[model samples]
Target: MSDLPPLDPPEGDGPDEAPDMAAAELALGLLDGDERAVAIRRVLAEPGFARSVDRWRTHLAQLFDLWPAVEAPDLFARIERSLDRPVEAPVATLALAPPTKSRLWPALAGLSSIAAAGLLVVLVARPVPVPPAPSARPTAPVVATRAPTLVAAIDPETAGVATVTAVYDAQAGAIRLTEAKLVGDDHSAELWVIPADGTPHSLGLLRARGGTALTLSRDNRARIAAGAVLAVTVEPIKGSPTGLPTGPVVAKGTLSPV
Candidate 1:
């Protein structure tokens, strides 16, 4: 009978051993944390290590493909009977066999590859209890529900003024404004939200386009609630010189939850 190659490197081997062993360990998911990170960096940076990892992965996949299929005819019945049995802690033992072969030098390289692949599969498939790393934290699932949105249609009170439609996203704290016509270049369109307190807080200046999105400050977002009024006014080139509106209110409408 032919001597089989060892699944792992010889016990005395250390970091000074060949890089092929490290690459194999990485491909088999044996390394963890900083060691695994360093291995991954090598795989990316070193062409030789990358090729080794690819070879190991391909060999392992081929080993899995070559594995014989077993039929568990009484598996369900066995599981049912085991349910009635009292649970006990699992027991395991480790045993090492003294080297019987002076050298496992197979005549063919294919024979060595097959032996190495089979041993790697066994090592990787063995069930081992692993405790979570200290730094690993369980994350709570984020449940996303639709955020409340409010829409307002600001109609022109007088002729020659553009009509505006406003959509407010409460979650994003931003308001999207759609206008029928662009505001004149000489005059700037200023947006304001008037809450129940009747205080108008300036949102920002609207651009001379079909629509624009304005992100609100925390204070301004709070003022944008149901029944609140959204008003657009013609101001100076930049905006209202003073905080308050200094020009005529072209269009205004009340916001309601959509």
Candidate 2:
């Protein structure tokens, strides 16, 4: 809204004057000072004037909604520079010299002769490349190796419930989690890895909606391998009350190298 002066009202709300014009002014925030105060009193006192103000406000709001917001460029520095110094006209200009005839052809001919003599000497002195012996053996091809990545498609305990896809990168020591469905707003989902020892170790809390990445500790990273069990359970918002999972396990699956 602009900080503008209030619009002057009509002398009277008579049959000849349009009182609705004043209502429009008030709705547009063009009414301030005593005029704004009086318009506010009329809005409270008269139901007809109140309705007029409401209609104008709604119409103006719809006009604003029709256009998308635009970001203004930052010109503060340029404005400050202009204020600090007045612009001045350039004092001098550079000009190119006119071309004239010269003995360039003779000079170019002499340079070409020198270059030809140097090329002849180099060609006479350079050694010739030789062919390899036919008995030489061929080199072996190189092979590349990549670190193993573990994947788990965690299935829901009950049919039609939330599911999770866990991918563990051994080299990065991080696990990427992709959740299928949302959990209860009051509760949070947690991830756990159960190794061959049968003890479940807490990985971290899972995000309710989208995919997330969790970096594991040195000990936790060592436990992640093929055949390890990956599970998700519903727990408190922060995490499980106990270090172990207290809530029911929602999804579980065995990890396999991918």
Candidate 3:
């Protein structure tokens, strides 16, 4: 057997076919048991056969586990059949052994090219989303309009003080007091709006100087239109004892439409 010719694979096989022949030889070597470990390792290094390498490893591991109990007939028959088949050559076959030092750079460059192409594909396919503008939505203005009736000032007096000037704008339905002054020390001032005919409604406390203005509610519009009396009293800080004026009259005004 040693002197016999190296088994020449069937006709049409040439040195160009050496790689496929080598792979088959490696596969058969895996079943032989002696060099099976080395051959299996070599098959794992071939990219084209890498997936099969895992299957081969699992099969071999099972064979090793059953080695003592029974022979792996199925595994041996499969390898034999595979070796008998004509080698359909791989378009590119990697060396089963490690590459020469000189080829390392070329292999690295090829892998980098593949990675760069993958990154470029990802960047081109995915786009970043832009946020919408805030001002695109509408917003209302603050301080919508002037209060219909604004009381501008108040006057305080000890007794029998009169004259509260009402600045009325008929179209806007508003009235404002332009002047209110306290005449004496004994009396406190209060503000009221008299409608066209109804009783005086208390707006709020009145200050002697730099007096404040008060806005009336919408419900008072009709009564104000009917001529309700706007009057002021020199009420105690707790307010007029009787719901009506107990203190001296201080100032009075009416709301005109605006």
Candidate 4:
């Protein structure tokens, strides 16, 4: 925490009190660069600040959702108007004359209406993407994070010479399956998710060799809460026909907290 960048100074007159205006400005994209970075940090770290930001976002979204659709002014026409201004031209050459002014962006400053038009287009049905959301950022590899995850070992001795491993990613709601010992191609390795109630649920099948990722449904994810068991069984191609296990359990282990 000490190594992280210092947060931007709060905007209120008092040191402890930050005005809701700060959150509104952040949500409205009034802050740029380091100020925006500080706001993003607050959104993730402080629940109160996050709620303020969400409230401002919802308020603004509702206000604009009912706003009348406005057509965009012709951009090319505005550019033409900007170019139509009288200016001295080089008469020495028969070739095309170069532009007299260097500040073209400043000249087209009137295009704010065009920006509003783009907003209208987005408001019709689609959304204009907002940045700095959690999903908008690149994810760090699971191995690189400091947070503990869950890993369970599949039954190693029963199936083959190779050992099998299962690592669960709670954020992604998926389990990664790694097989060090390859099973024969003729059979299938089906994964069973054993809940605390001693009931077994099928999580799907695994590959005969290498690694595979198995995703769990919302209800199934609840069953995987700590103290659950994960195991692999040798079954017929595709998986078990009956809901219950038909083949012998090859590998089984209780889920462990990292």
What is the lDDT, from 0 to 100, of the residue 56 in candidate 4?
91
Predicted candidate 1 versus true structure: per-residue lDDT over 26-68, tens digit per residue = 9899999998999999999999999999999988886776665
Candidate 3 Cα misplacement greater than 4 A, ranges: 1-163, 167-175, 183-186, 196-198, 218-222, 253-258
Q: What Cα-based lDDT does every candidate model obtain?
A: 0.68, 0.68, 0.46, 0.63
Q: What are the runs in model 4 whose C-alpha is more than 4 Å off?
A: 1-148, 180-182
lDDT of 4 at 105: 25
Q: Model 2 clash pairs?
A: none
Rank by TM-score (best first)? 2, 1, 4, 3
Q: Which ten residues in a row have the lowest lDDT in candidate 2?
A: 92-101
Q: TM-score per candidate, in order?
A: 0.43, 0.43, 0.31, 0.42
Give the Å shift of residue 62 in candidate 3.
Answer: 99
lDDT by residue (tens digit), candidate 2, 1-258: 789887776678565765447789999999789989999999999999999999999889978646754554555545444433423212111212222212222122222212222233223323332211233354333222256777776777776453455778787899886544535889988889999999999999887766678999999999998889988888899888898998888878778774
RMSD of each: 26.1, 31.6, 40.3, 21.9
